[model samples]
Target: RVRNAERCARFATRSSTRVKHEGAVSTVQVSVLLPECSSAPSHLDSVLNNFSSFYLIKKLPVYELLDRHFLETAVYHGAVFGLSYRTRIDEDNCVALMPNGHLTLSLDKDSFEILGFEGKPSRFKHRTATRFVVSVDLTDSSMAPGRRSYLRLLTSLKSRLQLQTDFLLSHHPGGGASIQPLLSRCDWSQHRPEVNCRVLTNLPCPAPLSCDPHSFLEWLGAVDAGISCENSSSSFLSSFVCPEPNTMHRHALSVSVSGLLLPHDIHRLLQELRRYVEQPRLASWVSMTVRGFADSPVSCSNHEHGFLRGGENFYTLMMFHDHTYQLHLAMGAHDVCPP
Candidate 1:
């Protein structure tokens, strides 16, 4: 999981692609941890401040996404990340717009019946088959504006289902320009990714690379949540403690961004993190965790995502001072393996 500093660029390139894939589906939150650091550098702060802004369309009609002009200008130009806001994966119907111009609908049996689209049953484990997944590739020849499949979906959504929900949407390469046509038609508001920073003093932490995966993640999670890890194993309130061979860092920095985040923004952040490490510094490592939208219809690389239990889909990347890196990708029981 670790690579030499010399191969950091190559490694970063590969990893950035992976993160982009995940982000393309939907990213709600990204958290970064810098142990033994008191403050963020100017460049790093700039990257954090400049994360892309996304739009929230209030009660956007599902068929509007299929509009000929909107598709040509935005979705086709580059990846457009869209998700049905406030929709719960386990209960309510959900929609996802993938980077490859695919529109996915996770619907319950009744909803699927009403929508009347050709789709497969849900892949996640369920006591009974009560859900279905309808995926339409907008770029397919058959889905061309006047084609049968295109009209079929357009009719189903526009007339039959009349699906309208608050939508969170963002695009790369084109940003607002590409999506302007779509946004102009809806009641929408633009929002920048919200950034939060925290400085911790005398924090107990384990050596990230040397600690066991489970233990280190547990410790890191505790730290991120501002939980006290100074507990005995037998303590009833909380048994969590810094792993052995740990050191007390005089100070550490934690920064997080929450919103409809894009891959381009994340890649830039990673580059800044690498740049931070390349400089002469006391900290030997930094960690970043990107969490996908729990209700997304797809996870990394367009894998079918479900919420059978936890609905967890996320990855944690740990970069060391030597340019070596470790990546841990995980998904919930309802999803396939992460890429």
Candidate 2:
């Protein structure tokens, strides 16, 4: 696993350099979240509170200089570094100590676990860091399992380190309900899909807008039309309006499609829409009422069909109806049909 992590780190470094040379925005800002610890170390705590932990790699004189300093500092402190980076809107760096006690690095490819800890291992050939935002997690193991301690420790180091720039501590959820409320209160401009999707998925639609539902439907249809024109194979798999009689309430509608569209394609579209929704320049009155389905079937006829694939056609229709009905209940505020 360690070997794989090294490989990933190397790849990321290379990719980052390519992006930089391409004249794209090369600077990335990272916010580290640390778990609360009962007995935090003073040096660690000092690091956590400091703001210079974030640094720009471009400002460094040489890669070897920084690499040597990083290694020496880490070894002197007897700590393991959990490397992370932001590549694109949906892709971000995340490394963890897995449950089985192996170090795993999730770096744009399949995660790799570290196999050994000693000796001068082969360096993963990649670009050097331009800057770093480090942080540590120090929550007690008995209270917080996994590498929460490591995360907390990193957070602390991130705070005090003067290597790059200031460290930003990401918002951490206290509980299930806490997430939705926190998301609701966030400044959308600061929302990154990779970091916030899990929270957003659980959040209920915010208070509905006062726009005409029919007008909104028309706009969505036009957008769908444009998408279809751009990609001919795409089709409106299924779409329906809520049947409930409530006219004052909002409605939830979905359209499903199946084609050559891969999961990555769908994900890209969703990410684009998310950015649009977060745009503060847009009118606050405008709201996004649609969600895309990619990897998973948009609508399934029967719940059982999901588990059994023999009657695929029949179950697919059933699932669509089920989803349609549920939308009615949630948006129209009436359980008029079965989801």
Candidate 3:
């Protein structure tokens, strides 16, 4: 039976890829039957068992003809693999697996014809048969969007066809990990469900949820500012921290700022942030976003068009200072003083 199955498989292989794409648009219908009992494994199983049995019967001539017919049509359509038969048999029951995993027992061949036979066994008086239909399509990465849409169609069909199970596995033919990030930073919120954020056993951080980017940064900054005083360095920094680091740093600052002003302003704000941490004169930098500046008393005149004109404009200004420190390489120590 296995040898016959292999022969049948070889015969069917020719049309598998083509049928997978074109589907059973014009195909033969294959049918199989088993005992009529409620305890029957399933109709699909019966159909598969019947096909396997026929293949094992040394019915090479019929199998080869059917295989050739399917392959010829599939090749005409430029298919890569042809549909092959899959079946499993237990002591008293048998089951068949189909490419599409449909629950029916009628297979539609490429010629839009049905094939199979009916049989009854005494041990398993009750039996059922399941049917499967398939089609093939091209595999081109350039058609990724189209291929994705096709896969989605398959998913829908699996539900509508009432298949027992179906899943999609994608692969690159050349076999290398594609380094495109699985999920984009901006789209993380949207694709979060697809992300596997499970905690592994014996991990350094068992309560991993608490170690996200925001919390980690906050923890680091707090420790740097001496909020965590368990360490000796934290205690020293807390005691020696200067109150007017911002003012002293601002006096010594020189910046060559040129870019989209928005980005330049952002860069300046970042520099101000550095001064808050390193300068003896600045303790903190305040960041703010102001809108509707035309109504403010300190509004500057727009060169191309005055504020009173119809055109709309906006500006972002960032103010910051500089911090100068002396490095003592021998002692690995530094001195923070106003620039």
Candidate 4:
């Protein structure tokens, strides 16, 4: 829960910033310096519509997810993506429903022992096995309903530990209908990812094409945080300022979407963003920033993900009107660097 708390705190800080901006949006980490260009905005709004939506299932038994009827309809199809809600990998027995038909359990020592499933020590943070990772392939031939191994797992989850959590669930093309069987048995609420946009006038922006990544990111954060670079030397609250040799934009656009975001929708957004940059306009570039789930058991490219200092995992993409672009990816010390 520590990871979740820390994430919440960060989000709270973001909330304060939003109030300062009167509800305008601030993306996690990224900024593009618009160079003089010609382009018209078209269908840019459709990108927001394509983003995947997710649902929250309250107090759901972990075992219930193993229902044969549900598995056959969703999991076996390799379209489901799920993870326990409000769970922090650094301090909780988290569950993950992977798209590849695997149910991953990252459990503590006692819970791992009770589950009775074969698993290896977690390679996150600690070298020794303070925690463990058990991944069961629901798609394996031996995992068919009523099989010995399947029954063993069923009993472990249903009768032993009785693991239950608020699960964040989503499926590809089928979406909600794909997992209706499971949702029918539990209390649930559906939610669409929320989007916020802010336009900054007389904004100071750095030349991303030339600025060092570190400094660029810092400037991006300053803008997102609404920190005043106009502070006088004697000002006490903050003395932050835009990077040197920056140019002023009469207007700069910042757009962000937050929630149980999916990679497919993000890809489509990128496609739309590219279209946005290709049109004739006055901005030099456009960008999209993505923030990963704090409680996720996996990060970009499906690598094992863990939380250390709030699990700082995110990336920024800047598309230039010149047709050249740069992608900057980062996952702080706790995760395998993005692929």
Candidate 5:
């Protein structure tokens, strides 16, 4: 019997809205709402310094994915990281391999069937058999060197269309240097995640303790997008305003890091944000957001992530000084509710 079967809540076990419906949204939004706690954990700065670094793989081959040496070093270390840089359109062919060693390939019908691996038809905007997904576990024992499954995929990637594309790769603990072998085979460049910080003056902030997660996140999104929130409902341009029961922050700090960010680093950032709220300061709260890779093979956990018009899978955490927090995890329609 499933443990805690009787204790399961309707929210966790119920059929998810994401799975049953199709929309412009195709992501898994699962937030872990946390109760207020008292203190912050230490060792934040050290963790931040060790965040994974991103790299560029120019003209990387599909068969090189089976490189035993590179796999043994980086992938085996549990630092899976790879994704195609997305343009405004035609990003459907994008490939993303998460640190969990899941390689997700978005393909057309010909490529999907020709590659001939186990994959499912895409759920987004696909009334016909147009798009497909091939999600393979690179770390699986069956995928080991020279195995039947491994060779088949290698042959498909090598002898088929001979696919090669630009990829952004990252590694944790060892950083990008760990994957140098793969980079040596092609034109590649290394990059670190860009961090930007700013201080806003006279900012309208929803009450840290009172605001709902969805509305608060919306407000934060507006801030990030630099849209004027003073508009009224009748305003033709935009109608976004602060949530009710709000407060004013004469001074607020905003820091953003962008790149192929890994989850391990995000967890460290969360720990640091909690500490910021614990300190005695004018600000009563601190908010943080972690956006998932749109082309991520797995969303929330192992569940498949799909993309439509908007592959929005992300969560915003509002942590109040009282140790209470509201986490809003949002996903698009082509995913299960996030865990």
Candidate 6:
């Protein structure tokens, strides 16, 4: 869907809010395209370089996430993004701590029974129902320290199940300071977001708004991967070609950032991109794409995520020079509707 970004002041604010809501949740990678630029501005570079660092806690106990200090300092005060590393959602038990202070667990029937928590069968269950989902709001009154539900879950994870796994965690507003207490208790390492850039020369491109959605995404993916689309149907490898009514851009910039990205940082990057496009420039449009983690148990909010044929969930935002934008949110066949 496309919206005139500056048609009205109030509507612009609402659109900005929607962008933050839809594009920021559990992003695994972000890619940006500037069709006519050879280099990025220093300020933009700074923003991209300064994305918050995240921590990897090795073999951390699942019950530790409910620590009073960690919750009071990080989860309650600001958003904290966490996920179990190297754990497959469909096979092994997977855990996710969302920004809204909710802890979600996707478990098999055996593990779910062992955990002994109140939960519902997974919506993705087939005829037999082998999976279950347990979601708990950490900020709820019943989850407060010394409460009945809080103690029961803590004991269940600590004494009964004793679940432990490698965890990836990060917090906004406080960053390392907020999560240091949790890190101090376990073996951990901190790392920054990885950034990559490529300069394309004489690249074929289609009209941003006029091209078909699937075809445009195909062309964009080819460009991002440096694939040659000059094949014919009779060719053996790939019969991909740039869509018709396309132009050859003399220079274009492709930049990407990958990590356990937070929504706040992405929102800042969008503001910078908007500022960059608003200035007098040769290119009339630019595009940003965000991809969610493939194995995540939840996509936008609490929407269940599953892998049927390569569990893909993502969105692309195309901002034009005239303060208008197009948003395309997509999911795999087995996934639920995106927010």
Best by TM-score: 6
Kindly report which residue stretches of model 6 are placed more than 4 angstroms away from their true locations once superposed.
Answer: 1-21
**lDDT of each prediction vs. the true structure?**
0.82, 0.22, 0.21, 0.70, 0.63, 0.83
Please write out the lDDT profile of model 4 over residues 1-339, one tens digit for every residue. 243332111111211121111100112222223334222244666667556777899999999888998888888998888889888888998988887888889899899999888888876745567888888899998999999999999999999989999898877865567788788889999888776656677887777766877677678767766776887667898777777778877777666667766556665666666766767776667765566676677666656777766676666666676666555666655455532
**Ten residues in sequence with the least summed lDDT for candidate 3:** 327-336
Clashes (N, CA, C under 3 Å) per candidate: 0, 37, 51, 8, 11, 0
Candidate 4 structure, TM-score to reference: 0.84
Q: What TM-score goes with each of the models?
A: 0.91, 0.19, 0.15, 0.84, 0.80, 0.92
**What lDDT score is found at residue 101 in candidate 6?**
91
lDDT of 3 at 249: 19
Which pairs clash in the backbone of model 6?
none
Q: Is candidate 2 or candidate 5 better by lDDT?
A: 5
lDDT of 3 by residue, 226-309 (tens): 353223335745542222211121111111221111222233333333334333432222111212112111111211111122
From the highest lDDT down, the ranking of the candidates is 6, 1, 4, 5, 2, 3
Q: Mark the 10 consecutive residues where model 1 has the least summed lDDT.
A: 1-10
Model 4: weakest 10-residue lDDT segment is 17-26
* Per-residue accuracy of model 6 over 177-237 as CA lDDT, tens digit each: 8788888899999888999999988888898766877788778778878898878878988
Query: Residue 279 lDDT in model 6?
Result: 90
Off by over 4 Å in 5: 1-51, 87-91, 175-177, 232-237
Cα lDDT for residue 10, model 4? 17
Once superposed on the true structure, which residue ranges of model 3 sit more than 4 Å away at CA? 1-130, 138-155, 158-174, 179-339
Best by lDDT: 6
